[model samples]
Target: MALFFANGATFATWGIHIPTIRERFGLSDAALSLAMFAVAGGAILVMGRLGRQVARLGSARVSMLSGVLFALATGIILLMPSFAALLGLLVLFGIANAGFDVAMNAQAATVEAAHAHPIMSMLHGMFSLGGMAGAALGGWVLSLGVPPEMHVTAVALLTAATALLTRPLLLPDAIPIDNASTTDGQHRRMLLVLGTLAFLGLLGEGAMYDWSTIYMRDIAGAAAASASAGYAVFSGGMALARFGGDAMRKRLGAPRLLTWSAWLAFVGMLLAVALPRPWSALLGFGLMGVGAANMVPVFLVTAARLPGVAPAEAIANVARFAYVGMLLGPVIIGAVSHASNLRAGLGVIAISMGVIALCGARSIRPAPAEY
Candidate 1:
């Protein structure tokens, strides 16, 4: 839940400030895209190693430390005097984000295992909820004429408080070593397939997060500040859906739920691309959120249950692949938009979700009987 709040706050920070950064740096659209890509690059370059570090140091310790870094990096980005310095700060934020992502998910998986219930989806939902609050707060702050430094500082303080509050709820290093041994031989192949599906799913998610507002403002003719509401609505719907997803998953099972989610996302993306009105486009984005809400959590659970790998190792491996998707999604969207229109570019994202819906079942095996 704390992680989710942090997720919300982080994106809210970025979404509300992106325009400010663009103005401050006198950045062209392409240049802004490249700077955003730099953040992804940092995450891609460091996530695998950071995952290993988390495994060695323990999720609780890593999460606490990463939270501090996350807060500090946000502060630096707000205070940096030059574009180059800001870019460097983003890199640090990216690294901290990567570590936070892996450690939190790893911790969640442990908690879920102990409870013998579906909790991962709800945890992610909390993140979406946090994101909504953060985005709203950011928009409010900007509207109230709060300076970037003060706004970001407020976010940093909130992040630190959440981290400390939730620190006690996270499990210690108590996961069974035997669980790691299950991913041997054929298990490795299964894990690879699950990881690939997760990668594709995450790519779609990243595109939505990084590009939805750009699409709205550029294609739908929304005002700069109003455009962010597209993501806010999408994220709000996702949070609500995720809060209910665990119960839904209990009724439908992971395989069926994922299949439906893919279809929903595909249809939602198509509508978003086809819709001409801003309101309709925002609704489409919301539908996409509903579709995507459960897929990642379901895949992460599958990864954790793979044979011959510890839950931590499995999460690390799969998370590395997911980061690739997250990194590529926005960059591809930006590149495509530079070459064509943003709408035409986002159409590819819809197609990718369609393909995932078509193939996701084949990519994941049923959870092991033991699980």
Candidate 2:
């Protein structure tokens, strides 16, 4: 949980510094989208191989090393001398962060398997809480005239220190699963479904991460001082919801829980598109945070439990597909906004959420044994 929290904080701190970087580089929306693509690309390229390594190397060691590397990469991003240098650093950041993501989740899955109840959601909740803290604190420091490099450096140090301190607590290397009969046609189909669902869930999440602040500032006419309010609201709602997600899942089950969540995000995005004011935008994003907070965790948990494939590989495949959404989300929104308007672009997101709700209902159906 501490590892997940530290990783989330590291990423969130970088997120809060984006506007400053954008201003420094004088980047257009398209240019920024391209850079975001580079980040996603790097992650996608490395994740499959990373999964195999986690299995061999033990998730704890890999997670710790990757977490430290992730922080270092994030800190260096602020010091990049040119757009190209920034892009390169972002790619490096993506690779290292992806390593941390897979390793941490692998660790969580191992812990979950050993226990009788759910814990992934709670661990993920810690991630959301870390995001909220990082964003709030980063914004506060920026307001106090701290440079982005200095702020990121502080976050990096904290992340590295926390991971190092917590290193001994993570799961140890385990024997490989012996259930060779687990993989079958049904399992393959489920893998495809889960991967698709992961894509949809993460698409919305990445969009919110990359675009919510910009939307508040540019579309909702928020003042410079208040632009980050939307992001804070979104992250806060997500944190609150994730803290409750495990209990909710135990009560409602995965299919129904995810179904409602997708609709919630849909409604939230609709509200934002319709109102387009500062407070309304914040409210809408908060609703979105609630809706999106647990979708990825649920998807990941499902992948971990799937029969046939190794847990790490299953997760990697799902992550590969899912992260495509994150990779393309910014570029798609940017292209749409460039041709039309952000409002229209976000309307597409609203509609996408509806599709996700329907698909989640079908894809997350109970296993045959449960039925």
Which one is best on lDDT? 2
> lDDT of candidate 1?
0.79
Worst 10 residues of 1 by lDDT: 173-182
Q: What TM-score does model 1 achieve against the real structure? A: 0.86
Candidate 1's error at 29, in angstroms? 3.0
lDDT of 2 by residue, 72-184 (tens): 89768878889998998888999998988988887888787777777888999888778778878888998999877888888898888887787888876333644423568
Candidate 2 stretches with Cα past 4 Å from truth are: 19-34, 78-86, 142-150, 173-183, 213-228, 274-280, 338-340, 367-371
Clash count of each predicted structure: 11, 2
> How many backbone clashes can be found in candidate 1?
11
lDDT, each prediction: 0.79, 0.81
Q: Which stretches of candidate 1 lie over 4 Å from their true place?
A: 174-185, 210-232, 273-283, 333-344, 369-371
Q: Report the backbone clash tally of model 2.
A: 2
